[model samples]
Structures are given as structure tokens and as C-alpha cells.
Target chain A: MGTLYEDRLAEHIGKECPPIEAVDTVCPETIRHWIEIMEDRNPAYSDAEWAAGSRFGSIVAPGAMMQVWSMAPHWPQRDLPELPIAPVDEVLISEGFTDVVATEQSQQIHKLAKIGEPVTFTVKLTKVSDREHKTRLGVAYFVTFEYRFTDPRGDLLGTQSFTYMRYRPEPESESADEPAA
Target chain B: MPTDWMKPHLKYDSVAWEDVSEGDELPTHVREIDTSLVVLGAISAARDFYPVHHDKDAAIAAGAPDVFLNILTTNGLMASFVTNWCGPDWDVTDISLRLLIPAFPGLKLTTTGTVARKYEEDGRQMLDVEFGAGTDYGPHCKGTATLRRP
Candidate 1:
């Protein structure tokens, strides 16, 4: 009747992982590519002159784009080396840890990210908990992580708080498909 | 004269200082959650790498009735809906959201918000907007957003 939560928590507790950081360098091409890929038509992210005239003075990356920037460093690229990443769900899943679900996401934008401005990201684990949802009849563990982004001048650009719930299969009688309590 | 940046055009203002009432409903908009777009969005947002969002087989194996939307994507959709209505000039000061149900893939999500309250804070005109998004299953997400006109 034990759950994967207990073992996952024990492995993560008191473990230290290298933080992710990058330069503030971004270009119009990068911004355009992201917009095109995401199908975002916001002028603030497309038209340079329009963005320049605004309070930000240039096209800024979308708040959601920052989340991608934060994770980029953790991933391996053919060009960048020496950047260590602590494998989380994606990698762990390949190694037998399964049942990852996004529980929550929140973001706060302080300043706009202009083209060619290097925005750095740093991530850290904040919380982890094991819970049994009787209603769903699932064994799940909640993991919370914090990400901070800053401009080259050390000014706070934004902060993102992400919460994830990873669950596992239960017995037939205790399945998540059961009727609500 | 760069396209006459200051050129005057037909202007019609809807909400006046006194016309707004508490608990008034704002116009709602529907955003179809394209499964492919949702998966791309999840990767772009660096959200939890849950296959229920990207891989159909993984989702089915994970015990999900089917592939579903990610919470982060839902929040972004809600924010985008409000921002689209409020125009590009408004700044989102705060958003408090709660996930109430699971949104299955390919289902169109209807996002609506109401003017919960209107008041002046720190000499700025602010509106307390509450938003809810749902599909056929029920309400998927609910939250309150604090918006200020710049």
C-alpha cells in the first residue's frame, strides 16, 4: 500500500542542485521565432517600433516565454558545456518515476525584457509533500519550485512559482475513477 | 511624420467612471485549445513534463481518462483572454487562480470574467476582475485578477 511519494521525497530532501543562469542576450529573430511558434500576435512582442514607444522601449518576451528561458539552461546543447542540470520529472520518468502532472503556475513581471538583453534564470526546489486524495483514490506528491529572472544590471525582471503533482496508479478498488467521496 | 502617431481616429469609450457596476459581467471569449498548440505551449512554458499534455499514450498509461491541459497553460489562457479584452494598455497587477476540474484535449474552453469591484488604489484606476474557464466537463479554473489601466 506504500506510494512512490515516500521514496521520491527522501531522495530530494537535503539534496543540492546546480542553479541555472544565462546572459541577457536575445535578438529580434529569437523573439519572432517564439511568437510564431506560439501563435502569439501581441504587438508588444512583434512590432519593434510600437514596443520601443511603450514604457518598455522595446519588444519584450512574453511572461510565458520567461519560463522557457529558465528551463533552457538545464537542457544540453551542442554548443554550451559545463552547464549542469539536475534531472527532474522528464529524466526521472525515463528512470522509472512516472505520473507527473502540473498542479499550478503563477508569474509576476517586474520589468520588460528588451531585444539583446541578457536575462538570467535561477531555479530551486521549495517544497515537496506526499498526499493521498481519497476522492481520486490516487497516491500523489506535490512539488513546488521557484524561478527568478534578472536583467544584466541585476534588476529583478520576474519570478515564477510552479507547483507539480506527481501521482501513481492505485489498486482497482482504490482507482482514481472511483466515485467522489 | 511616422504614420501620424498622434492622428485622431474614431473613438468610442464604453465604460465611463460611473457606468460600471459591481458584479457586472464582462464580455466572454472562446479560445480553442489546439492539442498541438497546447503541447508546444507546455514546452515553451517549461511546465511539468507530464505526458498527459504531450503524449497521448503516456497520458492513458498515467491513469488520466485522456490527455488534458496543463495548469500553466490554463492560467496563460485566462490572462490572455482578459488582456485581449482590456486592451494592451492595461497591466495585470495580480492573478489568484484555482484549478477546479481537468480540461481534456481538443475541447474548446470558454473563458469569462466579471467586474468584481472597481476602485482607486495608490491613485491608480483598478478593477478587480474574477475569471472562470470551463469546457463541457465543468469549470476547469477560477481566479481573480487585479488590473490597472495605464
Candidate 2:
């Protein structure tokens, strides 16, 4: 990667992107679909009777269902004009660093959202590795994107932090020339 | 990334907060990763279209053995592992994960957790549980999460 390009990448740090628009609200139907794949038979996530008789008094969405609320759409549509929240992935792809992988993730939930409440997200470019890393996947740069989720009533749900490695795989030959970073 | 529901489904009574002791062992949860629908459902649920998670040729080209599981799915698995063991009222408050190896199609993941500490914090019954998933690749994923039994 050129120094100028690297500098441009560095510029992304601290940049805040607009929140995803029209986030799907949580509902029993959505919750059921998730528990099906997870086999998460916890009554609270699915059984209305069990949930209503409990402290929550209604069916509660699983707290771990947080990230699914704000994942990047499979088909990309431009939502925010002030800041295109998803450019780092594009930059990585453009730079031939196409092998993407998640390295770490963490979340702190203020509380779980209720059914019929919409979930929205806002993210910030938290970090760009100062130095390139070498691995079986060739030279890679670490990109960390942090997300915050809120419900329709302006209540805080939780904040999720995850890191992705944008890597270019090394060629088969042991002595092949490598790109400059 | 489990697709079909368990054959003999489970019915659980909410574990009493007082009954859970520090150093208690939680039940093990096994996740069989079938590359077909199971893994696909997981990635699709997250809307994660990254090729490494799907598309066999793209995954091989990207240096992965095959279409592999994504972290969001792992997060769900980890949460379910804890919540299932702690019973109905128990919920996950915080979870942090570190992946040591890629979980592939043929892999079988056996997840277990140990209660590290149980205490009352601000009148909330809390347990800090350390959990891990064992795969064909050895120790695959490990993390600690806080679960609250109210």
C-alpha cells in the first residue's frame, strides 16, 4: 500500500458514521427465527406464557441477539450521506486486502429491548493499526469498528465492539515479491 | 450454527439464584457445524455476506479450508450456552470472546463453562462464568461472561 493511501486510512480513525436507518424492530416472529437456528430453547425467548409469568411480564428478546439488529445489509444501499459508515471495508477490498475475518468481539448490554421496538446503530472508526502484521494470510491491517445500539424509545440497549482483519493471502511461492505496506 | 431443533427437547426450571454456587459447573452444549443449512442460517441471520462465511470457492480462495462460521453466530452460541444452563430468569450481561482457530464444516464444537465467581452486586445476583468451545482443531474459542439471575 502507498504511504499516501496508508495516511488516508489513518485519517479514518475517529471518524463517526451515521446510524443505520430503518432498523428492523424486535418481534416474536423475529425472535422465533433466531432461536430456531441457535436451538436456544429458553422459554423466556419463545414461550409467551413462561415469559408473562416471569419478571419481564412479556416476551423478551435475547440480549445476545444484539448484533443481528445492525449488521450490514447483504445488498448494500446508501443510507447516510454525511458519512458512509461502510467505507473501510471498501478501502480494504480496493487495496487487494480482501480476505476479511473477525479477530475479537465484546458487548455490554444496558438492557434487552422488548418486542415491537426498533433497533438502530451508530458506529465510529475506533482504530487503525499503526504497523502492518504478517501472518499466513499475508500482510494485514487491523480495523476496529465499534457500534452502539438503541431502541425506538431512545433507550440504550448496548454497545458492541468488534475487530476485523483485512488481509491479502501470500502467494504459493516462498520467494514471491510482496507488496509494500 | 445449529439448524434443526434438538430431538428430545428440554424443559428447564429457572435456577434459583441462591442454588447456584461459585465454582459450579454448567452443562455442556454441543454444536454440530453442518456447512449446508446450519452455517448458512447463522451467516444469513446476521446478513454477513462475507465470502469467507459462505460460497465454497470464495472461501478456498480466501485461504480458509471451507465456508466457516462467523463470530456473530459464535456469540449467539456462547450466550445460549450460558443462558440455557442458568435457566429462564438468568440472562447474559456481558460477553467477550477470542477465537484461536477457525470452526469449519466437519467440526463438532462442545461448549462448557465454569462458574468463576458468584456474588451480589448492587442487589443483583451475578455470576462470572468462563466458558470455552472444543473443536477438532483443539481449543477453539474461549471467553468469560457475566450472567445475572434475578
Candidate 3:
């Protein structure tokens, strides 16, 4: 396998390809579990009567819950067969890419996701950048990617932008000179 | 007489509206960022490929001081603090956050907020909530939030 930097960059720049893949996952249990774990006592997420009387008209998933749901499809083990896509972990690990970092993330909630509604997430690698910084190993390249989320009906729910910088380790003896300056 | 179902978490049930002031400080909420929660949050949010969140070595190699906090996790923490204080009756209308410093794993962070301004907007009571997160090192993030009272 070649370096992830080389492979991903090639695919991104050469093929005019989108570095990130879009995938979807649906499991009512996931949302239910989140509500329980967080101890979210909000009637909109737990009580049928309260939810029915609310604007959403059902036990809608919390905004933060929907954010979590959006990322479920990227886990390595699920290997969403319908999409024929690799989990983000497998994809990065396969290309000998390591050290992914999220520099920033911003989300805007447009609407709520109701219970029993199959929430579909569309993860796309919106941008990629190669950055070089002086380190013990001199300079290294860093790659960043962004992912956006939407519902099954194609209504925009929120957007999450993640920046990951990838690079190899620097060799020793490269910075042996020591000068007090 | 029937009891109010939402009485437990309501401000009216305990404290009176006259007690809270524009500059009065709310109780502070503190948390330490652990690698496990950070990783779980990152993966769960579909931010799957970032190793710097889970891999310490990767973070060092990338030019970051350490496995830094993701923006989503920071936002979640801020939102949670507000919700915890205001109770479930209030809803978060908007949140604007700015990260000042990197919050690494094991760092002690304290979240503090104050009522900046309050007014009636469209027949609903609104509170201009200002929040911030700080560590022993310094401030990590500062922002304002809009909360509507029921």
C-alpha cells in the first residue's frame, strides 16, 4: 500500500474526486440509547403526549443526538453494504495514513429529527489541504476533510467541518545542531 | 389539585424570577476532557477519519500540542451546561462559540456563564446568556447563547 497522503491527494486533485464518502445508517435503538444515556428528561424526546403537543409532533431526537447519528455510518465495522464504502478507519489505515486531527467544527441546526424517522446522513469530504510545519522531523504534510449531514428527505439538517492533518515521522540526526539564540 | 408534570426542573418551583439578575453569575460546571469521550464523540458525530483525536502520537507528529478538543464536543459541553442550568423548559435558540486555546486530555475545565441581557422578543421572554470555558492555563473558549423561557 502507498502513503495515504499520496493516494488521497492523487484521488482528490487528479481525479477531481471528493476525498470524503457519503454514507447512511439507521437504527432506532441508537437514538433511544442516547436519550437514556444522557438522562435527557425532555418530554419531546421521551414522552409521547408532550411530543405530540410540541412543534415536532413526536419524540424528536435532540439536536446533539442527531449530530451523533450523522456520524454512525463512518464507523469501521458497520461497512454499510448498500453504499459499498469503507469505514473511515479502514480507509485511512489502509493508505498508511495516520494522525488525523480536527482543527475546527461548526454546526447549525435547521430542524429536529423525530423518533422512528429514518435519519439519513450524507458525509462528504468537502475540502482537503496539505500543510507543512517545522518540527523535529523538519516539515510534514497535513490533510483536512469536512463532512455535512442531511435528513432522508434531502432537507439540510446540519454541517460538520473536520480538519485532519496527516504526516510521517521525522528522522533523527536531522536537528542535532543546538544554538542558544 | 393536579400537580404540574414539569415542576421538578422548573425555576418557578424553586427560585423566584426576582432573584436572578442581569450580572448575577450562575453556578459553574466543570469537566475534564478524556480521550475516550473525545473519541466516542468524534466517531459518533461522523468525524471518523481524524486520528489526532484518538492517537496521541499522531497529535505530536501533526504540530498540535496534544490531542486537542473537537469543536463539536466543545459545543456540546457548552450547550449541556446551559441546559443543565436553565432546565428542560428552556430551549437553546442559538449558540456562537470561539475556541481560544486547545483543551487537552486530563485538563481541568470550568464553564461559567452570566445573564448578559434580557428582553421580551415576540411575546417570549429571552435571556442573552454569555458563557466561557477556562482551565488553569487560561481561557479555552468564550461565547454567547440565546435561551427562550417558557
Candidate 4:
């Protein structure tokens, strides 16, 4: 199973996943929701009047909210579309590396997330570990993926490189040895 | 959305790029994590429905002690931390984060940062800041963020 999946993962290297368009634009309602939850009081993000006088000349979404725009909706179960990393995940899961954890995320902003603007995200599978490595949870493989955010004109807005560790869960009996201290 | 959550407090109008120097320390900011921040930040704010971020049982099943904050929320907190220190006139041009540990609920997340470099690129003033957030378990995450001033 390990060798079979490992070879499958090797085939996906450097392939770009299909781009996903945001269901909503960069609008005030969504921005406000993020700001409220984050408790961020930045005038540039909420106060239109104050923002108009600033360098941005208008209210802008939080730079960190870039990824939120393109998230897949939570309701209305349909034939689930293959997620960007689903293919790779399938290979990992076949070998019992079921649980995943995000380890690193780095992003570069080229354009601000302006209100009413729609953003699209494109992901590319960059790297897959050649061999398994032992992790605290169990054995795992590290996968690296890159995300590119663009606008309607295809102008680059930002880019993020994210890394996740796909690991097998320890047996219940083994974990129970150190139950929550 | 209700506007009542908006706070009235404001930081400085802006930190001029010309005035900032390398090695300058930013004001430390602290936040108390609760189950609400973890869940809301995942589902409502970030639109992330990852179970480990909101369900303790799921997290424990996956080997975590409890529900923990997600990467998107940490990114938001990092942005807020920097802007609160440098004010709002600047825009984030880059942010790189490495997760060292899980930020579980009931811990005080203390964040600190320092201006690492000052330079000009493409006619815009740029600053690279090294920052990190930590809990009682040690560093939760740390990275550098680049800010551009117009």
C-alpha cells in the first residue's frame, strides 16, 4: 500500500489543481464578520470615512482574509467535487495516514483585497516526501502545496505556500496510556 | 452584521516608514483563547469547518488535548497584532508562519515582534518584521511579515 500510494503521489508533482472562484465578493458583510471575530479595530478595514482619508483611500479587507474568500461552502451536499488535494489525500489515506495537520503557511500580498472584488484561488502540488518519517502521532509524509490568488483580470493578488503533515493515528490503547494527563 | 463589535480604540495614525528603524521592538499584545474564538474563527470567520478546530472529541481522536486554533485565525491574529502596533496606514505584502505547537483554549497567547529591516522596493517603503506568538506550551507560531507603506 505504501509503495503503491507513493508512486501515485509522485505522478501529481507540479500539477496545478483546478482554480476555485469565491462564492462571494470581497464585501463589507464578510469583512465585518471577520473583523468582529478577530476583534481587529483597524480603521482601514472598517471605517470608510477614516479609510477614505488614508493611503488606501477606501476600506479594505484584512490582508489575512485573502484565503477566506475562496473557501468551499459548507451546506447543500451534492456530488462532492474533488478537492484540490483530494487525490493526494486519497493516496495517503490508503496507507493509514489519515489524519492531517497544517504545519507551515507563508503568503505574499501583491494586491489588496478590495470590496466587491472577486478572488480566485489556484493550487499546485509542489512536493511529496519520497519516504515516510516517524512523527509524534505516527509515521507521516510531508506535502507542500502552493496557492495563487488572482482577480477577474487574472492579475495576481497574493500567493501562499502551505505545508501539511499527513500522519497515521496512534492506536487507542497506546494513546490511553497518557490520557489527558 | 452587527457593528457593535467594533471597538473605538485606535492606534497611532500611522508609523512613517522614514521614522522606523531596524531592531525597534513592537508593543507586546496578549489574547486569552477560549472555545468561542477557536470555533467562531474557524466556521464563521475563516469559513473553515475543519473538525479539529471546533470539536474536542475530534481533536482528541486525532491526538490533541482539546480543540485548538486554526492557521487562518493565527494569520488574522498576526495581522491584527502588527497593525495594532504599527497602525493602519500600511498594507501587508507578505507573511510566513510556522506552527510549532497547538494553541489550545485556556491559554494566554502572548505575541511579540521586532522590526527586522527597512528598505525601499519599487518606490514603496517596505519593512520586514520578525514576530512570534506563544502560549504556556512555548512558541505556537513565528514568522516574518513584510509591510508596505504607500
Candidate with top lDDT is 4
Task: TM-score for candidate 3, please give it.
Answer: 0.61
lDDT of 4 by residue, B1-150 (tens): 333345466453778877899999998989999999999989889999999999999999888899999999998898888887777778788899888778999999999999999999999889999999999988899989998886
Q: Per-residue alpha-carbon lDDT of model 3 for B1-150, expressed as tens digits?
A: 112444353232222345657987878987876775566555543254467667888777766667766666677777667766775556666666766666787888899999998788999877778999988768888878777765
Candidate 3 collision pairs: A71-B46, A100-B51, A100-B52
Compared with the true structure, the alpha-carbon lDDT of candidate 3 equals 0.56
Q: Write the per-residue lDDT of candidate 3 for residues A117-142, one digit (tens) a residue.
A: 55555454444443234433323343
Off by over 4 Å in 4: A1-6, A78-81, A171-181, B1-7
Please write out the lDDT profile of model 2 over residues A22-78, one tens digit for every residue: 457777776777777677878776766666687777777888778877655556664
Q: Report, for all candidates in order, the number of backbone clashes.
A: 6, 0, 3, 0
lDDT of 1 at B45: 48
- Those runs of model 1 whose alpha carbons end farther than 4 Å from true positions after fitting are A1-19, A22-41, A73-97, A130-137, A171-181, B1-21, B44-50
lDDT of 4: 0.82
DockQ of 2: 0.44
The deviation in Å at residue A97 for candidate 3 is 16
**What TM-score would each prediction reach against the true structure?**
0.75, 0.86, 0.61, 0.90
For all the predictions, what are the DockQ values? 0.29, 0.44, 0.20, 0.51
| Per-residue lDDT of candidate 1, residues A154-176 (tens digit) | 88878777766655555445455
Best DockQ goes to which candidate? 4
Clashes of 2: 0
Worst 10 residues of 4 chain A by lDDT: A172-181
What is the descending TM-score order? Answer: 4, 2, 1, 3
Best by TM-score: 4
